[model samples]
Target: MAGGMFIFSAVDTQAKFLTDTLHPFQIVWFRQLGLVLGLVFMLSYHGASILRTAAPGLQVLRGAVAAGSATLFIFAVSYVPLADAVAVTFVAPFMVTLMGALILREPVGMRRWTAVIIGFLATLIIIRPGTGAIHPAAFLVILAAALFAVRQIVSRALAGSDNTMTTVAYTALVSVALLSVPLPFVWQWPTEGWQIALLISMALMAALAETLVIKALELAQAVVVAPLHYTILIWSTFYGWLIFGDLPDLWTWVGAAIITATGIYTLNRERLAARKPPQT
Candidate 1:
């Protein structure tokens, strides 16, 4: 899963590259459109049965938030370094912790909450609020992470009711709808071979990366799966340096390490807390 996640950064980098040639809306649209095709094939085995009683509203809400989150994240990556844009996404794990306590009424012990706060502190390290090093575009990533957290919360609510396949399918349909709405304003033909290559690159990576993520989760515990979060920093850093000639500053690394540590600790703590002290 970690390895798969490392490849996922390619989607971010490629989307940012393509954003120079295509709108985030168009890039996102192609991504979801490709995913929708992949999802249809996966759902073929289930026939119409997969359409049973999952919470459609929550699913659609998640789709919209994910659409917006992805759109904003890509938009920010165009202005910020790839690694820096990705570092700000560390906010999602922390926000998910808070959302679980507030929205799901899940019991969170003091230690876990402290870890959450520390995680946010890490995000601040990257942004450096008082300094001008942070781009205003960074806020877009922050908001994206926040909405993504809410989407994850909604996922928890609907977990057993829908399989991962159903969620993936919903993502395809709804994100496509969400991303397509702005096509009229941003649509343009690819006039250059480089532009065509960029779109194809973005869509292909987005489809493969997301599909592999779903597969990765099936093979491991979500908590066990969480550490893959840090792999994004590693991959993003490479892409930032190699493709864009942008290297993250010290604060970005500091924040990423802190956030990665806190996120890991919190996941372990949550797993420990979920235990029910074995039935007598």
Candidate 2:
């Protein structure tokens, strides 16, 4: 999971780099291109059975949410600082906890609820809504985080019936089909050889990152792997400083620390709860 986060951070950094010349939609489309190719290869090897799903509608919904989350995130990062954008998206775990309680009827204890409140407060520190420091685009990342939360909830629902490969395959197919709709309108062909290479690299990295995440999940329990998601902040911070010379402000770091702390606590609580005997 840590390795996957690092790769994803690289993918985000590359997307930010490409945003200099390409639309966010175009970048997202390109990123999904590699996933489509990978899915095609898997289909050829495993046969069409790989795409089979009992919940096709839910899978489609998950794909749409994934597509929206990816596009919104790319668009947000294009305008906002990488670390700041990433920090805002950290709220997804909190959002997931809340959504699970309300939508999935999963019992959320008081401790997790307190952590959720603190996590959102931490996000506000980065957003600074009333202050002039906030960019209008920062809100886009928050929305993207919400969409990501929905994706997570759907993933939990689908996990009982569908295998990981089917979920990944459907996401790739749906996102590619959705993005391909507007791709032609916003598409700007890469002019330079390096730009072409970077686009291909971004696509390949995106697919690799997804595969790594799936493997990581399979290899470990979700609670055990959850904390590794925080590693992206470190990678994002490093890439932001090294590539873009963008350093997060003290408040951003402070806020991120709070969010990360609360997120770990929340995960730990869930882990503990999962081990408890069910109430009769």
The 0-to-1 C-alpha lDDT of every candidate, in the order given, reads: 0.79, 0.89
RMSD of 1: 2.1
lDDT of 1 by residue, 162-230 (tens): 777777778778899878878989998889998777677766677777666656555555667767777
Give me the candidate number with maximum TM-score.
2
Best by lDDT: 2
TM-score of 2: 0.96
Deviating ranges (above 4 Å) for candidate 1: 43-53, 278-280
Give Cα distance to truth, residue 221, candidate 1, Å: 3.6
Model 1 whole-model lDDT (C-alpha atoms) = 0.79
Candidate 2 C-alpha lDDT tens digits along 1-280: 8888999999999999999999999999989888888888888899999888999999999989989999999998988999999989999989888888998798998899999999999999999997868687999999999998888677767777888789889989899999999988998878999889989999999998887776666666566787888989999999999999999999999999999999999989988988999889
What's the C-alpha lDDT at position 92 in model 2? Answer: 90
